[model samples]
Target: MLDLTTGAVLWCALTGLLFTGLWLWYDRRDHARLAALRHRATFHCIRCGNLYAAPRAEEPAPCPKCGHENTRLKF
Candidate 1:
């Protein structure tokens, strides 16, 4: 009993809503993972040999010991 125009509009609206929900979910999950990574401590500066903490493997945290830019070091 639905008209073509109405059906198209409804379908578009539903698709938009579905995409929005998916985006929100993905963002939330990503934020949670980043938060967890931030709390972890695992990095060191090769130049100064100073130890530092970073949340993730790609973070660019500096060393507090020698004031040098640090890279992530695996423990």
Candidate 2:
């Protein structure tokens, strides 16, 4: 038979571990999603040399600084 205080401590430790594991899982998932988005949407302006992001790899990634319609280069 477990003591009352020991049981309470065990419950608290289990809850804390559960929450921490959940947080880490969420954080890793978000990081992967963000990384994929970053790799897809990355671009650089040819005119002003400014880096920017676009929704898709289509043409005319407009530069916010110089207003240039930059095209995405194929790798």
Candidate 3:
């Protein structure tokens, strides 16, 4: 009877740990995906009326169609 009780408690603890690990893994993956998306700066060229995205938001990126430097579009 004592052995059976101990086994049940061990199994419950193992299941809880497994769920916690899976939750943490998924949370980290989602955060990384969102972080990558947030780094891309969207731009719109007034000269050629073109819209595009480039890495980093602090600087200007040249328009691919018109070769015009455009500041990052504000939200």
Q: How far is candidate 1 from the true structure (C-alpha RMSD, Å)?
A: 7.1
Q: Write the per-residue lDDT of candidate 3 for residues 1-75, one digit (tens) a residue.
A: 569889999999999999999999999999998997889998999898999988875468999999899998887
User: Model 3 clash pairs?
Assistant: none
Total clashing residue pairs per candidate?
2, 0, 0
Q: Pull out the clashing pairs in model 1.
A: 37-55, 38-55
Ranked by TM-score, the better of candidates 1 and 2 is 1
Global Cα lDDT for candidate 3? 0.90
- In terms of lDDT, the poorest run of 10 residues in model 2 is 35-44
> Which candidate comes out best when scored by TM-score?
3
Report the candidate with higher lDDT, 2 versus 3. 3
Q: Which lDDT value does model 3 have at 42?
A: 89
Write candidate 2's Cα lDDT for 1-75 as tens digits: 999999999999999999999999999999988985775566689888998777674557788899888876657
Candidate 1 local lDDT, 1-75, one digit each (tens):
999999999999999999999999999999988887667768768887666676564467767776676667655
Q: What's the candidate order when arranged by decreasing TM-score?
A: 3, 1, 2
Q: List per-candidate RMSD values in Å.
A: 7.1, 4.5, 2.3
Highest lDDT: give the candidate number: 3
Q: Mark the regions of model 2 whose C-alpha exceeds 4 Å error after superposition.
A: 39-75
